[model samples]
Target: MNYLELYILAAFFVTTYGNFLDVSVWEDNPEECGRTRFENTTLDVADYSKARVGQFPWVAMIGSIHPDNQILFFCGGSLISKSYVISEAQCGRLGQLVRLGSIKAEDTEEEKDCDECGECALPPQDIKVRKQIFGNDCSLNSVQRIIILELEKPAEYNDFVRPICIPTDAFCHTSRIRQRALTPGFGHIFSTLVGVTERKEKFDDMRYVNSAIVTQEECNAIYPDLLKDGEFCVDYPKGVNHSCVGDTGGPLVEYLKVKGVARAFLIGVAKINPLICEAEDTAPIVYSSVCNYSEWISNQIVSSIEAERKQGRRLFAV
Candidate 1:
């Protein structure tokens, strides 16, 4: 009623919200270091200056929007299709900006040629939302177009790095045997983690992290339990990293089909990194399984693509 009464109510709301862990704990990660799958390693890897797919371009997302649209603060995303994009539903809630086709990714090179087109290269694919779906609650994206991309049969969630890729006859294959999948994201260099490692090399410090798809075994080692029922995983004996932060909603693809999505996997999701980073040994990164939900994934991408078609965007026909 009065100014003092209003102040009391405001204070109550502030206190309530302050104690809320509702905010994603992911910030404690890349904010202070790198995203989960993308461990802050001292290994001198690839250069981010190139635009590649199934690797970095597919795994990154856009950052908080900028009023001036010159250089966008991009996150990470996975290219699931020529039209669809996937990432954590939470990003939508956090006011995170997600423009599927617009993303260049963590290690992308600026060129007009890097669009999703023929397989084995980035598709000249575009991103346009048609029907967005949420599973649990209003805790999902603000965008109403979201549709559920779930397994044929619903399953428990895993806190792992699972990504999804849109599938098309021209864009995918059925074989599960995989290798050197790509993943990427933008975050602090390994230097951000001061006392986390014992690598005694300086050159290792100059590397930029890129995106690539990895095997489930490689990734599951960090958090074995993350490979839930509906979810699937992949590994790269050659160091295919898991989908990390700035990579939420990105695709965890295999050849072509959209498989998993990137997220912390806390609220009912599998903990992709069971151990996350326990041993310093040279082990591979574990990725959350996406293909396991082939049925659900199919429905999701199909629905999304069809919607896109209606909106004037050409989509791959199953």
Candidate 2:
């Protein structure tokens, strides 16, 4: 089905069966963020590989509906809270519809595609955007190319949909150089052909790449004058893996143990790179650092609630 059709179908399910859906507005709890029951056990494979169902609970598919009613999924994002998502500023105006809890991008049914192991995820949640907040210095050349999206309504957290943790002060201060990170998205599997008339094939199921954070010095060596204060670089140990087209605005996360529990922490927002998935050129992907904007994010969330309250809208804790 087309994008508009899929959205209409999703709305029908919520409207007709709203009472039976396992829906609840999650409280804003740092400890609870980034905790997921599903474990991705396919780490031994190549860095570029298909993600298992429910592997990345915070990954969001950002799509825009055209005048013709066709939907184009141009970017990926991460759910930072029940009411907010973090993505690249470039994706801010492109689309507002956010799809969560599905590994297969084409699955329009309320319930996502089940795996061979009989593992099934909860129905995908399609949320509309209420507001878009761009970073103060967001621009193509700027390192702070981040955008925050406020959902029309709070999302209900479940086994298939959850939030990833923003970096705490403690986590940011520690050395992160050479630390491994994962970036999941429903990006195109192949590089765009310059003169080809046919459309490029995209990943039907979302895929993730395993890469490591490189030191600023290492990043500068490749792209001098590109590495800035609010950005970091990531590169796969094996040169074949790289973020492709449609992967922009997705989260670059690190799995770390916090208080004796392993959680995925948001480290960066995938920056838009002109050179993507080129086999010959293995340039590290640059991402806007999330740690640098933790304070800004907090302030925006607070300000949003205050603004809503002034307008007399009943706001719940997120």
Candidate 3:
């Protein structure tokens, strides 16, 4: 092997290693060591309306093993069916509870304005969870009729963060479908102050991170085996906005309804392209087709609503 041949071999190895890492491994901070390891490119994130990086309103649905409910399974879910906090079963280990809604999503002077789900100028809505019932295995939760997380507002359904329609059919085909609508509790955001400063000091610039919907085939190539048969993935755009530790349980929403919950939060599986690993860019993400499990979700919704009615009639003494 001459020097030139050796150089060619070295270049080939380098390119192969980079590509291999691209499809499977990522460096959260390759500059750091331990936290830096192979991660799924398809993870989601959570936010605090603009108040903080990954704080309140992004609840972590914690649970317990012996029914005492201790382990914290922090998935990001919204107040949509505040009466029934929806999330993934595998992430459900038992006695789960919601967390921090203290922070408000009001906008800072920099970002100017947004919507109810955004940086609304007014004080954001807040509530304490009276009770929450997600399936430990949709079967058992159904048997015991305590499904509703019990909220007092159907009025919450005006425009921002209302319950999206659940697909009537649960088992839909993912084989050839190319596009989908996805939503997440996570948003790639910069403080409104930052936006203002950037505008004032530098050229006009806008940067935010939110989840996207990608094709199954493209996602499959990058995420060849991370999913377990029926499961899929979703992500905000890349960079500071992609779904991170807090956006679990949040909806992978589409149209104006709940299509899927962000399971990537607790599941901890993603594999992003190294080139786009930390850029303020967007990439269509994937989601577990909840449409495939429509019947199961419907049963939960039906059972919960019926019980709510019966309890109401009983209170009225009808």
Candidate 4:
């Protein structure tokens, strides 16, 4: 092909696929990696009030707008990048908007000033679903949704807002296993003296549980079918709290020590296991393994940008 033809093809490729790697702000100096939290504690509890403010910066609430114009929380999600959220496919069903910088459930109500933090509250940022679920692979069935939120403007990062790293399989294999990972979301506490009874109403105060990674054999035993590719389970044995309803699509995060400092990375996406979650004895809480789909997650982010660029070109051509 002549130089002119080659130029045209090159231009087409660039216009069709915007350069995402060059534009993403996810890359930062290693020293400045995880700086969104205020406090770090060794306590093991499920209470949101005890949680350090801005502890889970990537934790997001997926919301839906009611007819009366009020927003309601339906499921939880994790901000993997500035523009992408990784969540369970089921939670993306009514997903319309995503709110960030909230440590409490009631913080979603309105943007208010935090006297202690000395900064005004951040409002919920709107987002769009960029990619659908992968094809009928039962093994990867748990990884259901990827939403690309529309940011009105670039979000200002402070101590309360930051993105979490999506870990590759290599990272998990080398450093993630056997480490305690934290899963945070809002849900009800159930008590079962006679039967499963709701001891407390689901509140907005974020609740969390620290889960330990379990072997594939232990995870598969909970279900009749064998564990599929890209899936694993975490132990939430008796007396150990597990994720329940209202926390779907939330992240299973771990702080991997790098150079003696722990940096947080999203390791799993919480999945439903009604029997295990309720009983809290034998069965384990299943998670859609993030390490298995690390490549797919990267592709979706880039591909989504490409799709958007192509659409823009079409509109201009028209």
Candidate order by decreasing TM-score:
2, 4, 3, 1
Model 4 CA deviation exceeding 4 Å by range: 1-34, 39-49, 106-154, 175-177, 188-201, 237-246, 259-261, 274-283, 313-318
Cα shift from native, residue 192, model 3 (Å): 32
Give residue 140's error in model 3 in angstroms: 15
Q: How close is candidate 3 to the true structure, as a TM-score?
A: 0.43
Q: How many pairs in model 1 have backbone atoms within 3 A of each other, for residues 3 or more apart or on separate chains, i.e. clashes?
A: 96
lDDT of 4 by residue, 189-308 (tens): 211112222323455466566677887766667664846677777764345433463366777877655454566777787765444445633456677777666656555444544566
TM-score of each: 0.40, 0.81, 0.43, 0.71
Clashing pairs in 2: none
Model 4: number of clashes? 5
Model 3 C-alpha RMSD vs. true structure (Å) is 20.7
Tens digits of per-residue lDDT, candidate 1, 39-103, equal: 22223344322233322333334344445643233223443322333444443333233333223
RMSD of each: 17.8, 9.3, 20.7, 7.4
Q: Itemize residue pairs with steric clashes in candidate 4.
A: 89-144, 105-204, 127-149, 127-150, 128-149
lDDT for model 4: 0.56
Scanning candidate 2 in windows of ten residues, the lowest lDDT window is: 190-199
Query: Please, what are the lDDT tens digits per residue for candidate 3 over residues 1-318?
Result: 345433443343344223212211121101111111122123233321232222222232322223453233233343323343444432332324443232222213245334334543322333334345454445522322112343333223222222323333221432324233234332212111121011111111111233444455666776676444445555443343333312323444333111222212211112222223234553433334454444444454455455756688421100
**Candidate 3 whole-model C-alpha lDDT, 0 to 1:** 0.32
